[model samples]
Target: MNIHDRPFFAPTRRLALGLTGVLLALTVAGCASGSRKPQPTPLEPVAALVSARQVWTQAIGPVDPLLVPAVHGGAVALANAAGMVTVLEGETGRVRWRAEAGAPMGAGVGFDGRRVALVTRANDLVVLTERGVAWRQRLPSRTFTPPFVAGERVFVLGGDRSVAAFDAQSGARLWSQAPRGTEPLVLQQAGVIGAVGNTLVVGIGGRLVGLDPDDGRVRWEAAVGRSRGANEIERLVDLVGRVGRDGDVLCVRAFQSAVGCVDAASGRTLWAQPADGATGVQADAERVYAVEANGRVMALRRSDGARVWANERLLHRGVSAPLALGRSLAVGDAQGFVHLLSRADGSFLNRLPTDGSAIVEGPVLVGNTLVAVTRNGGVFAWRPE
Candidate 1:
């Protein structure tokens, strides 16, 4: 399933932070590209004096309606609406693997570096290795989001509102627990396993729950602001989970336009601010950057949730989450355009049309190359001139 961008409001106070000189120079030049369609920008071209390029391009599926492809370990893996996992090479858009799951694999695919895993709407955990099916285990219900891969364990959310852990290698049932609420919509990547805190954090409808790394248990829980109305999309909008020391901090953006940051350690509300149409949120040691639903991007202090800089002209609405490339930010929108912005001041940098009709899935930084994925299943790699 694709993430939906929702709107939210922020306090009026402007955030103050030191801006880097090198980043400012890049930001100004990156935004210099005019708002006109043209040939694909050459790889290793000049923008703000720095070189860039679009190195490679490849199409994945049938490219019918266009779907947001997920990036997994040097590959763009797509579980098309037809219910199959298609893996494409990261550097070159070459097909690495394809497997039929029979039903439409609704839950987006996830990878543990070695294997690509998909939990279908039918509650089946289909794991794909290099050769083929490593293992397949049925769960309780349909998985709305990708599973969380931690060490040798993979965490899947069941339709019965429980989180189950399976051995990544052996596909053995490690542990399972029915938490009070559902897990978050975003999937998580594992780092150091069983270090501390919960490994999985999920927000079902309006409540957030944390699960144990060793065994799925109730580490903590918090109630988020819910949306109103009869057809009130009972599910939590889109949640972005980021790793933290104590636990992962989940940013849940609701359709009703509310944003909250919950600490997975104690299941407490760290801080929350009014926000609307927030697409993607990325955090650094200093601040968290977010792309609003209307294509407006803003940065806020990681500590107090204060607004830093707001750039509305970078890209338009229906763009993918703003991706961070060191001091630079890249985003692709509905217009099939990739934009590079300055992370220091949220200034526009370069705008290049990928010459495709699909929504941009990524401005993913693969090594020194910037890879943007189009909805038409095309992958374009850009590099510095």
Candidate 2:
């Protein structure tokens, strides 16, 4: 039987309803007031620095609002709203394999070579292999981020304020750990986890934690930002978007708070700059890129977090995370337009339009192609010309 179809206890249903109401209230209060300025409309393209043409397009299924494509081993894996998983060839967009979970999916696809992991709407973890279904384990709570598979373990961050690791091969629970602090209500789109060397780097509620992947013990912890307000709504500082790491330097952003980088090994704060954004930060070898809540994209020197450049042309366009593509940076907007800007000076170089729906997640760079999935369930691949 599908896990989501299982019955819920009366008390559990009540608690879920209460949490839903709280989340609704928080969403309403989070939007800026009438005092805020209007956003700029997308400007006309100046000149084409590099031509981008769609290589292929495919329809997996209806869009799973929370799912983003996972790329590994020359393949891009996508989970649609209908609980179907499709693996497409990176170069040609050909379907390699397709499978179904028999239930709706909660989060995106997480993959590592032979194994793929996904979370179900019922809060269960499902692992798939080339052969077929490997194992399925019920999770303690719902998850939004993809299951992070590294080494022999798969780590999942739960909305119940915990990070749990399971044996990748056997689906046995290895260990579970939570952050240290009062659990402020977390955003549904908030948590992010990845591996930095041997440690599992996880961002939850304004703090970045490095966990020992083997035992789920705390290796190091650093605050990306802290709450200063009195009420729960005022204290909702979460690490937004995906945690970015280039070498030993890891950078992340806190919702309505700050963006900073730290040493992945010891959790030493390299430098932090005050900024407000719901999107995450991206870093190359030398600089970190951030899109503020207002849609202004800023580039900072990775060494000391000095401001390199800021582009305000796309202000309030609902930009996704900035993707570093060679000498240019790419960002997708709410209107499904991908804008390419100069990496050195933030000058607008080119723009391309998709299905006119929002690219809910940041574009994934696969080899020389940019893979973008729209909210309308359009998966597109563009190659530079």
Candidate 3:
């Protein structure tokens, strides 16, 4: 269902009668004014200050917005709903390797150069290597966030709010964290999971928790959101998947609640601001960027969480999470157009095009090329010229 503010549910399975779905529809309608969806803002004449060119195009079949292109050095790993995973050279768009999971995938392409991990709809965590499928392990619950591959281990954030670890080589169960309190409803979208320093940082509900990677012990926790809504559906506050990382500090969004930065090394909340958005954020050294409910792009000062600039020209465009590449901010819209904006003042820099379909997720940069996969499964790469 297309909500006027933003997407609360990117449904692959039918949630036709769920209370969350119904309440979300009502909640989004309350935010919008007119009876019909707003038309996307028309583009003005393009500025020729920055020049970019299409580098290469590859196909991997159609993908949903859940799939984010994983980059490792010069290689980028991507997967489609049909379980076809392809690794391509980022610069030349050459196929490095390809593998199939033999089932419909739920989430995937978590790569650490040598190890690739994906989860199937049937709840199997499939790990692949350059050679082929390395091992298949059954998970305790359904997963949305991609398996985070690091420290010779695969860490997964399950939809049930469980965290488990497996050996990268043998697929042996090392440690598991049981679901943390009873949550009324959890987001079907991916939650943030990654490694910062020696601590494995994970988003469990609205709290950013840091656990010891060695034995999976809780080291510290920082709250980014709280359950203050009137109902269970409104009370749902889960961290969106992507992150803005500058050294040990990480910035993440608590679904439609707040955006905050956390110190991974010390487990401290640097700052937080009330923000109504469902997608995660991107950041550079100076600023943290987010796309709000109505497609407003905001740049927040990294140190103090102050508003730097808010650009509303892309409103109602159904833009994806932004990619902070070099000096420009790039985001793909529903019509398969990538708009580049100035990072300083959020001015329109340039416009790029792809096959007429939504880009599946945010763009990933590799070696000087920005790679993006479309909802129609068109993988396009653009290099600055």
Poorest lDDT segment (10 consecutive residues) of candidate 2: 9-18
- By lDDT, the best candidate is 3
Weakest 10 consecutive residues, lDDT, candidate 3?
Answer: 1-10
Q: Give all candidates' CA lDDT scores.
A: 0.55, 0.75, 0.80
What ranking of all candidate models by TM-score puts the best one first? 3, 2, 1
In candidate 3, position 367 carries an lDDT of 80
Residue lDDT tens for model 1, 1-385: 0111011001100001112211122211123343443333233342563346667776554432223345545666666656667776766657788877666564556664567677665668888766777788987654545665546667676433456789888889998776443333322111111122324566544456665657666677676555543321222233332222212554444332455666555678777676764344566656667776556778777676789898766434455666666667777776577777788997666776775654543466554667766655566777755
Q: Identify the runs in model 3 with alpha carbons over 4 angstroms from their true place.
A: 1-35
Question: Which stretches of candidate 1 lie above 4 Å from their native place?
Answer: 1-50, 62-76, 92-96, 121-123, 158-161, 170-172, 179-198, 222-255, 262-268, 314-316
A best-first ranking of the candidates according to their lDDT comes to: 3, 2, 1
Give one digit per residue, the lDDT tens place, for model 2 in 100-208: 8768987767876577789988878988876777889998776877787767677898775589989888999988886455464656763577776567778767788
Error of 1 at 181 (Å): 6.3
Candidate with maximal TM-score: 3
- Candidate 1 vs candidate 2: the lDDT winner is 2
Give the per-residue lDDT of model 3 (tens digit) for 160-225: 788999988999999999988766576777778887766778899899998887778999999998
